[model samples]
Target: MPYSRTDLKLEIQTHFDKGFSRDLKILDVGPGAGMYGGLLSEYSDILDYSLGFELDCLEIYPPYIEKFKLKEIYKNVFIGDICTFNISSYDYIILGDVLEHLSIDNAKKVLNTINKNNQKCMVAVPYLSEQGEHEGNIYEAHLQPDLTPEIMKQRYPSLKLLYGNDSYGYYVNYNFNKMKETLVIEYNNLFKKPIKPIYPKNEFKVNFIKGCKFEVIGENKNNYHVEFINQKTNKVIYETDITNNMWTKPSLEYFVDFKIRITDQNNVVWENKFNAENKRVYIHFASNAIGDTLAWFPYAEEFRKKHKCKLIVSTFWNDWFKDTYPNITFVEPGEEQHDLYAMYEVGWHYNEDEDIDYNRIPSNFRKMPLSKTAADQLGLEYREIKPKLSFKKNKSQISGDYVVIAPHASSHAKYWNYKGGWQTVVDYLNDKGYKVVMITKEPMYDDWHDSKLGGTLKGVINKTGNFPLDERANDIMNAKALIGIGSGLSWLSWALGTPVVMISGFSEPYSEFEDCERIYAPKGKCGGCFNKVRLDAGDWEWCPEHKDTDRHFECTTSIKPQVVIDAINRQLEKTP
Candidate 1:
């Protein structure tokens, strides 16, 4: 025992004060001396009901039982073991210092039975030293083969280990003061299973040229038992263990029916099947719509050398024309459509030519090819070409007196409510003698006024909906620092190698792309909404529960404006 009746009474009183129900039907198992029962009676108004069960009846004498009138507060005081008692009738079951007496095997059996019958049970065990003396009956002390808290948790996955205490000298003081004994509850048998570890999904789309060793990502660190089972023979053909994360090139024949089994120290954890087909290059053609055209340019350079075929890229703008490529050729959309080997139409345009060969196209976009009508209008030849080249760029050159706060996103749902707390951040920075620039789309300024944001400070510039895509990129590239909600602009800022402090509300930080200097997200269940997909299909949206509830985005609200400012200053001070 580690806590007295006074402490227990105070704890119960505190629990009630914090809105715990007074009509709690509590069940006490192995109530050693009925001191706990006596304490519950002191607060008759708060504790509406209680039940006590004891194996030994002599512990609670006639005088102690009469003093509290135990039978009046509770339904019954049964004289029997808890293992046979009906447990569902009560709300809570307290098992105080009773588990250490039983052997490991017997205790497991009792725990299993309790788990099967009860919804929740609180368990208390002594934090026994490596060696300790017990003056009681030899059988009353803990057995040598008793299960510890850690071992018990493994056996019972549904159990949730709650609060525990490790205080000494309380037991001696309890005897001297003639007070109730103390014991710590270390484990609670909850009716729910613990959450399992999250495994990354295997939807990675990789484009690799033939004869080159392309790295397959999204594999966990483990012994991957690689096996190629021939579909024709129904037998295994190749077998090897991939010890490292990187996999080298195998024979071209070995690509078919490739099965990978990843195993840990004890058991197989993941299995993947790779289907082989003729490797076709993917060439994406789009208008100069932001940097969508640039995404496919690097990959085209790599595919041309390996395939030894003419790589033709059709675009609206001639930004890539200056860079000479012996193997690669550039053709405008409508200039020469018939001479190209394959065609890649950007955006939502589709083709209706039924006789066109589909196998030559990229696998991801082949299902819906470009329409012949749209291709004729744009004057572009459709060619399927996959660009291959590692892309790296120099860091953004920051040269400016004021820090820019470009918080505009494409969608309203994607926008952070500046009315909520962003205004506080702008005001704080302004008051500290730092200039602030708020850049946004033109339509946003007409709907919202900056006057409410505590009068415009010195050097405060509001350039709304004016800069074009390239100009916006240049503005971010030259800014002292950029801060905004997670959006395409944030990704663009990252691509420019500019330091960014992004406010990620519901989405997970896109770790694959680099750009985020520091990310601020709402804490708790609603924080990481970026990775989650809703049951109903549409564009992703933030948690509606955070919108208008009493809690009111406390997850986001808790993150102060000063915190973001500190993170930005730290990044500026760091050695590059």
Candidate 2:
């Protein structure tokens, strides 16, 4: 009755290892044999007496207090039952292996009493242990013998599991501070946890700054000055001089080496630098565009390897890379990302508000190739890395060597606007003993212009219309080459290892992969508008320079069919 289990004692010590750091008062509720009091005294000595605590104890039996030398170990010992004792306020109250001896109703009342003034409390309970009256002491009997972890959680909803195993669990009241908002601490079923919290001071707490947003919290931010700086640039991204109980800010860059410094009223500066090593880091793809996701997905793996952290990734096309990237954990968008040390969102952000935006990249994203933009944002090596696709080649429905062409783009600006360009190329490929297959979702030319420039390409095999990406991938894989605009399908064709003849007047020649046979007509025309202008998603026919004139899409329109035909011929010659 006076001694605690060796394992249970070690578990309780682990809590103290992470819970508090300032000099304060601690009340061990039932220090029957000075088991907890002696442990606390040892910790006080280990931390040097300056930051140690005033250890006290409350015991029902007066004889045990003297027998266990509670008077020598603790500064004060109150001889009374904790259930009926008029408890005074303390910084922390421990009910280690003592709650089961009291009735459920009395235990609840005691917990409510100690939860005043935002006081913190911890409890250690053995779920399956049962004990009768020990040494003829009635108070030592287990009154609530059927208590389990589920029942404890049901009774005290605010108690979060701090550390535990199947036999016993250590829980702490998360409403520890005086602030109205409950402190958030993430816990899972894993053991061998992070040990960073035990080294902080008692004034204010800074939650792990991660996942695009961060929060600095305390009872009040009266004279506090907080600054978040980009370590690499040595520029202060955010600075605040005391206004409220909490301060928060958001960053756009997916990966930023940040240094957070806080100056309290006493001029004591507390600073922390961001590190993702051995921590959980999340990378989210903000775009549903297939090409964009594939372009950026490989960088997630690169980030994981470089940082040596547990990486979590979310993308629209998770199945495409889930099997290929086994080291990364694939999650859905909006799923709860718990206890992340850092998080980054990768996408093309245009027309962002200067006052609030934290600049996701250094310059106009259009200046670099598609995939390199992600590399820049995530602070990785800038190279054209092709993401591996998970879809396998299926049995071909077509009999012979074929050519795939995706003429339609999401916007008309991305289309090959040259009049009758697709028909000429389709005819050219068809006559050259290669079966041309159209893979666009639309069967006819139906964009903002509603022009009849491309309709199943006259004599080619029309495989166009709503097919799965896997099936589309299979068709492209078996084909000799693919001829299309600067769109997602072109990116997919490149990823599938099929040579692509990419035709575009709107974008620069180096906008896509370096190996693609790029066809562009830049003579006497305004071109590369997609990268130059802030794209308006609402406008289907968005020609920034000349939308209403005939030169509206001359970038692609002026691209002669002969140029694309020559590119295709070059690819065929090389592959053959």
Best by lDDT: 2
- Candidate closest to the true structure, highest TM-score: 2
Q: In candidate 1, what are the lDDT values of residues 1-576, reduced to their tens digit?
A: 211223233333232233224466667665544444544433332333331222112212233234333454345666445545666666556665555555666656666766666544555555442323233324345563334556546654555444344421111001112111221121122222332222222221222222113233432344545544445456765455655445643333111334444455647756545422233333445545433443334444544454454566666544433254555566666665433323334343223753322222222222322222222222234343322222333353333355667665543334444344566666666676556776655433453434333234234576657666665666665666677765556555655666777765544554213335655454453554333432122533344455456544444545566677776776555413
Off by over 4 Å in 1: 1-282, 285-309, 314-400, 418-420, 431-434, 443-445, 449-459, 534-558, 574-576
> What tens-digit string does per-residue lDDT give for candidate 2 at 281-321?
88888999988987888888898999998999999889999
Task: Please provide TM-scores, in order, for all candidate models, with all chains considered together.
Answer: 0.37, 0.65
For each of the candidates, the C-alpha root-mean-square deviation to the true structure, in angstroms, is 30.4, 15.0
Report lDDT (CA) for all predictions.
0.45, 0.74
How many clashes does each candidate structure show, in the order listed? 29, 2
Clashes of 2: 2
